[model samples]
Target: MGLLNSLINSFSKTPTSLSERVTTLEIKTVCLGKELPDLEHLILIKDRFPRREKIKISIENETLEEIIQIADIPNFQQYQNFKNKFFDDELEVMITIDKKVEDNKFSIYCFDNFMSDFLKKETSDIMKAFNQLLKLNNYLIFEIFDSSLVPSLLLSTETMVFKKADEENTILESDRLKKIETCKQNSNFYSNSNLELIPEDFHIKTDSNSNLRNVFEKIETLLSIAYLSNSAFLEKSSFKIQISGHRMSNYECDINVQKLKNKEFYEIYKWTYTDGNPADKLIIARNAISLHCKNLDLINIDETVFASIKSNFALYQKENVMQYIDLKNKLAEYIVKLTTTSNDMIYGLFDKFKNNLIAFLTFLLSVYLIKIMSNQSVGSVFTKDVTYLSFLILVASFLFMIIGIAEVYFQKNKIVNGYNELKKNYEDILDKKDIENTFKSDDLLKKSI
Candidate 1:
């Protein structure tokens, strides 16, 4: 009688223990657009639940199979629900699958507390078994959530690539951190589970679907702007003349060509750097386009120049030509002004140093003269009667040296303040206003179209 009671008690406790484990489990899956074996074709080989009780089955299938036991489950209906919800035409879904085990059986349930080492291990094992059973060639991403609904572990068979943070500037560093945080927040699996997952949001699909043409256009625009900004401060000797035009048949004289055979217009001939200064290939390509637009009338020209490059010269339409030129000239003038301001500040610094140097030299000379006058053999004029006068001269030289040092310090502070203001303005012009105006103009054009 005692042994029978003990066995019944153990059996009752098994279901409760299993139920606790199941309620804490959370599963997230990311399929890498790979074909999976039919679920109906899978054959259950074994069932081991909260108690680890394993049962063997004899069945034949195209692939090896196994069954995970969950407590308090009566049928396969719950599992089917999970599979149906995860299926997608685009082969991507971010969801949390929940199951509960109780009373020595398992059934699918709503998500509750998910934080558990045991649950994480179980989820991982299930994913691995599924991969093997389906003979999947691509890796699946898995994440386990804790009781607080926060992910405790993210496991994937594929390597993840992350953009490196810029360490040189505080603003860039902050931007990088924000980007990372945004990526995490908008992540397929981690985002608000209610939001429907889109294939474009997935990293793998995004890489494949990105528009290369648009990307190249943006690169070209940025390169052109960079070239213009750098050339603004270049010396005349370092500026190479880039002439592109056609010789008019009627006049037998070269006239500036505005349009190419392909209906593209000439924007601006880039001021190339002399001495073969390594240039951005994108900028070089822009310059080639400009030349092509200029020399459209020429019978024989290098066709290879247009080989792989897409012409964005059409973007520089006649309507926008004057505006573009005006913007460029304004930027150049701003840079030149900044250069002049910096030069003036440097000269002021040098002048202050020279003045201080003179004052210091005068002090040293006065001290040497006083020493000579005080020497009994060298100067009897500095006898007891005039000894006080010598002391006064020494004190005055010391005062002058102190005053000179103070003046230099004050002048340096003023120069530094001016330079700082100039630097702020320069950065505002180059970094903020220039890019802002470019994009604004582009946006305006787009809207007008």
Candidate 2:
């Protein structure tokens, strides 16, 4: 146990290099025979898929030998039977397939020489396309062969195994205690469960230089997140990781970097035990985002980190941007109110002036009519006598003007005061009490009705 502790400690303190070889890209999808497109449509798929080399479509039908273009197939969909598209015996990879023809699934395999072709930017497009191709959220696993630091064989055993220390076992226990103490010297280093989580977030910084082990560790973290609840899977594990409702840790997942240079690589520790859950949207989304981030080269990131980043994005957005929006909205609301009050005051003044002008003109016409009818001169008619209606018109015009002025004053006092209070409150935060809007004392607020 003491020697084992030493090996683990030595590995932790140093830098290690991981060599990656992209071995195989495996695609799994569930489709009915009819779901498979006709040869005419099928030949077009290669156009959508990646790889510079031409895609070969394998269909066991006598009518369509080799499909080069959709134009040549000529009514293939009308005559061809859907059942023959992926017969259980046809696909070599589906070893344990269902006997029923209706409930069949298949995997498509393709590869090129390890170096010259597979790692280019177009592979990113291919991953995005494959994500759409996946059915029922079943994942397409991308495998990269790696030299693991902890051999896949060791993870299943003795992870958290402990024995009672007695008089006979005092020496071994003391050695364990001392080594444990040394590791714990750095706070947050040791998990209550014996899993040794790395301190920093994983990043594949550049295509030329990046860590592959981080890739595996991240996937392992995701798988643990995805399937920690399945009791059957837990029983298979040798040790228990700390858990609450979802997998929780003292460590945090990083969301900064966007794309990885290499496809996701996980240690064979998972492959040795159980196949992961079939429909993990979390895993599927990560695969697509990694590809997207890679193709665009806008940023480099780990895919799983995106989940944490997105989950908390709404709150972060509200915190930073919403405050500004609220302040601006309050400012806008008050400004609109102030502008409406000024506009209404001007309109009321104009309306009152127009009404008075009409009334004065009508009084003059009536006075002239009465003077002509009674045979009196215009100057005498105005000074001595006028009709009752003409007199009422002059009095009403003056009253209307007074009422309009009063109403405008009433509104100016009400709306402008509200705006002042709002401005004062806002100034508490902005600290800009004495700032001017530059039209001088008629500062909109100080302007008379």
Candidate 3:
């Protein structure tokens, strides 16, 4: 009874929550520097719908009629009009298919709703159908949005290339692509690519094996591609990839990589103004740029490129002034520690000097008392055995004073040595030499440009 009630609830849509529910989902594939197979060829494949029992397939109305006419080849315009009307938007499932071809790119979008369990279950079947369509392409990305609303679930594939080196079943086996694979393995940010009902909330799951990790991994892989791709930074680069978008509407979230002509560098920016936290987005941008900097260093890129990266770092620091203040506080604390140690050392030597003076005064008092008790003059007290004892006391006091003075001298020397070391460290931290050198190099580069 409980299971039946849950199933009923899942299928039923509340009028109050209608605006919050996902109205559409889209999947896009981009083949970098390569053209993809035609939409007509994919749709016309007779055996593509082998698993028809799992999910029903539908095209737009006119395209459906054209499919019925076995002798006719559906033109691009016919394919555009053919909407997947199998699912009802108000009641049941509404599925749609659209294909786009622009220059060297090809794209496809599959749109559906959230109110049906059947639609959720059949997502894998839909992807399977699309996969068969896109199998001939070399580079592909499968991206989907859970809702049209803000803070929605975004699942996407990492930019992947189909390699001829491996068997046809293995699409990502190229040795040259190891860097991207490494980034994917290390990233813990994305949802799993497996087909499943989208979670109601965008909060990260606490479990280690959740789908969110897969989503993060895919994002990292994309970042790696942006950071490592050389052609992305070049001018008039002939090699470009094919990309697809929804025919019905633009993607809710997208990443665009462009080469900056003036700076001669690549910029990878995300186009999701509605869905993400601004701070998180800033962090993602900074991290991607940092990774790009490391890559630039490894390749021994031109000094001007590094200078631009340095300028970016300075800009970032300027934007977040609070972080710079915190850094200043840390340096101040280190200086205080050094000053405290120097004070302690100097004070210890002064304490030793005070003790030596006290001891010498006590010796003089003892000599005076002995002279008074024996009914002798101060001069007479210095004769015979008394004289010997007085001389011994004097020698001992002199020796004690000399040792204290030596110890003070040694401590003074230590303080001097410590101060010199501290000074050197301060000088290094505040050094303007490196800054001057960098400025000179940048000026030379600017003149050349």
Candidate 4:
């Protein structure tokens, strides 16, 4: 028992090294018949490699022809003992480079001359092999290869085996301890799960860049946020993961955590592109934002970020711009109330004066009818009563005219003056008020859309 314990300790302390170094690429091809053509041309290149290097063949099809063809192929010393393993009939053929390399140092050299030549030949062989392999299933078969061959091999279903660490001491250093420490410090990196109630009065301003930063920072800061109980409140919390550069895109990820722990933590990681570009950076950022909000439910995004993108779309469609107009008009309605109540009162006064002038015109016609119907001679009527009647009519008519003139004059003046007042106020007062219509809100929400 003592010797066994000592041996185990020694092995545990040893640096885990790669078992073998191998480069792998996949070829998907369809050949035209039941019998696959001679793969000799391809095998010759394989033969040129060191004979001691082991190559293994695994077939997906159970047909006798498929087995015969696979068996005819050369096997590496490492794979020689495993030749019978491929005889089990399946519909797929997987030829693996049976060399184990350390997970940390996996490399695929596609740009090399030898690899290029080998691929040229193997590409045809794979096509022919597929043709023979799929003769029974005459569906118009198409093949899709992975973008890179190296990672595919490393993660292949049949070729790779994942072994979880047996002992706690063997576990790789994780962010678990750090996340627990952050939660205990109570920095508000996030809401406490124990406090399930998001304060009802909590109205988070979606307008602050700092808010966005805080959300994203929280995702990175509280690693343990990931391990909480699956509550709806927890799911609704905004967590943000920012993907900044183009060099990191490609992998899709989800949060992983263990159950049964009183305190849980979130571990965030993503697969990014090795080849970096401006577009990739933008895509990464967008994808990260989407995933963060979508999956972990973290971060409050403001309209400014939303509108910056929206305005770009609106440039093509005028009708879509109505939303902006509506918002502005609403704000203008509030501004109108604040700046110009006296102007509205003046308008009301002008309206009343116009109504009185209309009634006075009706009275003039009645007076004229009364004069015509009277028994007085036309000349006398004009001579004796003309002065009084004319004076009275003239006075009344002139009063009505003055009122009309005054109403028009006041209306024009009010409009002009009111406009100037509004302009001056906007520049001097309301524009700086940090009100809804101020440039501050527009500037904040406009960037995102």
Q: What is each predicted model's overall lDDT from 0 to 1?
A: 0.32, 0.35, 0.34, 0.33
Select the stronger candidate by lDDT from 1 and 3. 3
TM-score: model 1 vs. ground truth: 0.26
lDDT string, candidate 2, 345-377, tens digits: 798789779878976897788777987899887
lDDT of 4 by residue, 1-449 (tens): 12111221221322122121123433222222222223453355455433433444333333444442243455454233233444332333334443223321122322232233433432223223323322222111111122232221121111111121121111122232333343233323233233311110011212222322232233322232222211111222333233322222122222122121111111111111112221222233343444434434333333433343334333523542464455457557744553455455556666766766666565655555666798544555445564576668668767776876686567556645654454455442232343444434444223311
When summed lDDT is taken over every stretch of 10 residues in candidate 1, the lowest stretch is: 164-173
**Residue 169 CA error for candidate 2 (Å)?**
67
TM-score of each: 0.26, 0.26, 0.25, 0.20
Q: What is the TM-score of candidate 4? A: 0.20
Of candidates 4 and 1, the better by TM-score: 1
Cα RMSDs of all predictions? 23.1, 23.1, 22.0, 22.5
Worst 10 residues of 3 by lDDT: 242-251
lDDT of 3: 0.34
lDDT of 1 at 40: 37
